[model samples]
Target: MEISQYSAEQIATLQAKLEKKLGPEYISTRPGPGGGPKLTYAEGWKIINLANEVFGFNGWSSSITNLTIDFIDVHGENPPRYNVGVHCITRITLRDGAYHEDIGYGTAENVKQKAAAIDKCKKEAVTDALKRTLRSFGNLLGNCLYDKTYTEQVKNIKLPPVRSSTLLLDVL
Candidate 1:
């Protein structure tokens, strides 16, 4: 969430890298308003959704119904950086073709403690959601950057352009 720690270009590059590594079958980016780039959560979900998409083993639709991430607050006095973070509920719903029949919800706050100290309720919400989704749905996360499968998958992918920054490496 610390914008000062990373340039917008760095963020874009990291996102592009993730997309390339993860494959686009179950992931895609939503363009931002100013044409600057895609939103961060939109970028992050390329892997997150892919992981959940494998849940069809039990007759449940395994695709994310929705996902949202946003900068909740900025902390630190001298740095004036983004510290506190929140993740809006990233939802995965079971569907029957066009009509969704069953609903299950997970939030980062549901697993991790809400960032009461930094006011990062949303960030907590996402972590919690991911944890709960994995627990409830069984670990179905497919080839993701962190997944062992991704290292091999990357070789098959053509890397995309990106800016460099350690902040972007935090998720790794």
Candidate 2:
């Protein structure tokens, strides 16, 4: 992945805006191994929206550069399965003469029993690749979702104190 065109300050500003836009609703908890809490990620629509806000509508474009499928051995009593891998390249142009390109890879398995397995795998691969490519832009769009340790750290991070009266007034 290429380095981000945006500077640190610009990325920080974008991160703050994204945090405000995506509130607690974007975060979810799941059951991890040993009955521990696990962090779940929201969809990538927010990232796309933020990218559009930061850059113009045509600032970024993603397309599948390559795709391949490999057939695996069929197991007993199971349908034949194939592994599909997709390579996606995304280009983000913040402005004239300022741009970056990033490549992301995604793989998914599809079984013959499933109808439209190839299509489903392709969609999953595309989404995964997009998420990975977007995450290359640092934490602006909740990149912590890809990092377990960072997710835990974020959970422990303290929020600024809020005035109770201000909250009450807003509610009233």
Candidate 3:
């Protein structure tokens, strides 16, 4: 999506705020099945809260627009595995009444969890879709994680120790 000049400015401001609030520890790195490192969701509520603070309460929203499920036998097991995929749309309404909407897609396979395969797959797909949608917002919310080099670099960095006074519960 083409971001307007105003939106770009807002995003830059938000990026600064996010970097100050969240540290490298908030980014997760995992080895993909193919041996390449991948960035995974470590914490998502932080992004939601930051977005609310930047855009105002309820200024942003996301919804799942489509979902599909397929049963496949990866291991030739008796019980087929369910693979779920979802498409989601997220929108942010700017203060000036203009809006930006983005679409994200995600897929998840059966996790071997009990009888809750459907539920688990659905939840995983939704979370992945939301993460992708938020990443489309740019560098503010861990989009840099998409870069393998960046992910490798940050994987070893430690987050600063939290001071008692800076704790969210303490602030509350």
Give per-residue CA lDDT, model 1, range 97-125, as digits (tens). 22122222322222222344234444455
TM-score of each: 0.26, 0.55, 0.62
Model 2 per-residue lDDT tens digits across residues 46-157? 6677667655577666655555543333333555665455555555445433544555555555556433555665566566567666655556555657667656655665
| CA lDDT for candidate 3 | 0.59
Q: Which candidate has the top score in lDDT?
A: 3
Q: Which stretches of candidate 1 lie above 4 Å from their native place?
A: 1-21, 24-91, 97-118, 131-149, 152-172
TM-score of 3: 0.62
Model 1: lDDT of residue 89? 36
Query: Compared to the true structure, candidate 2 yields what TM-score?
Result: 0.55
Ranking by lDDT: 3, 2, 1
Comparison by lDDT, 2 against 3, better one: 3
The worst-scoring run of ten residues by lDDT in candidate 3 lies at: 67-76
Clashing pairs in 3: none
Count of backbone collisions within predicted model 1: 19
